[model samples]
Target: MDSLYLLLPVSVLLVLALIGVFAWAVNAGQFDDLDREGWRVLEGGEEAPTATKAQQAGVPLDPGQL
Candidate 1:
């Protein structure tokens, strides 16, 4: 019962803190370019040019394999 009191307040505070930070980020236009980021991933625009070249060259990379 004593631990419940401590844990509840801590959990509520953590959730409220996350909500506050998310609200601040939304107010600061952090979500403005959300669609562009997702679209870039689908369009493969986020890939490195050198990686594409290496793929075309048939030269296998060690850790940067496409």
Candidate 2:
């Protein structure tokens, strides 16, 4: 059928476009840190290294209070 001639080329073009996008993603480092994120979740995630008592109290730390 004549429709097949149109549909076939359109389908091929779509497949090629998808492949191009996937290749671009690979070259752009989209998949580079795949495992690090998974491992990070298992590591209990990051937390600030320290917080002062005044910070927790929502008050500016006054040296006199210490």
Candidate 3:
């Protein structure tokens, strides 16, 4: 009976804390782009930019050409 008094309030507080966090997240737009993130993972990642002329011509960009 004594443990019940302690445990019940703790459990209720925990539930309320979780609900508060969820409400804050919703208000902060955390879930606004739900679909965009999922689709981004499905699509291929961005490609690297192409190399410059010096790189393609095999010319050393620094002092050492060979």
Candidate 4:
């Protein structure tokens, strides 16, 4: 029963820390493009707008590369 007193506060602090990290990520735009990478992989190595990231990074994508 005494352990519960410590465990409850620790668990609550863990939950709050996780929530803070998630909030920081959201504010930092980490979740802004969740499906973008999935679509890029699904689109395959074939050339397409999948190179948008590379293009934005000023790196050119070859005609046959993802």
Count of clashing pairs, candidate 4: 0
What is candidate 4's lDDT per residue for 19-55, written digit by digit as tens?
A: 9999999999999999999999887886455546768
lDDT of 1 at 3: 100
How much is the lDDT of residue 27 in candidate 1? Answer: 98
Ranking by TM-score: 3, 2, 4, 1
Please report how far candidate 1 places residue 65 from its true position, in Å.
9.5
lDDT-based ranking: 3, 2, 4, 1
Model 4 alpha-carbon drift over 4 Å, by segment: 46-66
In angstroms, the error of model 1 at 30 is 1.3
Q: List, residue by residue over 1-66, the lDDT tens digit for candidate 3.
A: 999999999999999999999999999999988799889889857996888898999977886654
- Candidate 3 global TM-score: 0.64
- Clash counts per candidate, in order, are 0, 0, 0, 0
TM-score of each: 0.54, 0.61, 0.64, 0.61
- Let me know the TM-score candidate 2 reaches against the reference structure: 0.61
- Which regions of candidate 2 deviate over 4 angstroms? 48-66
Error of 1 at 61 (Å): 10
Point out where model 1 deviates above 4 Å: 41-66
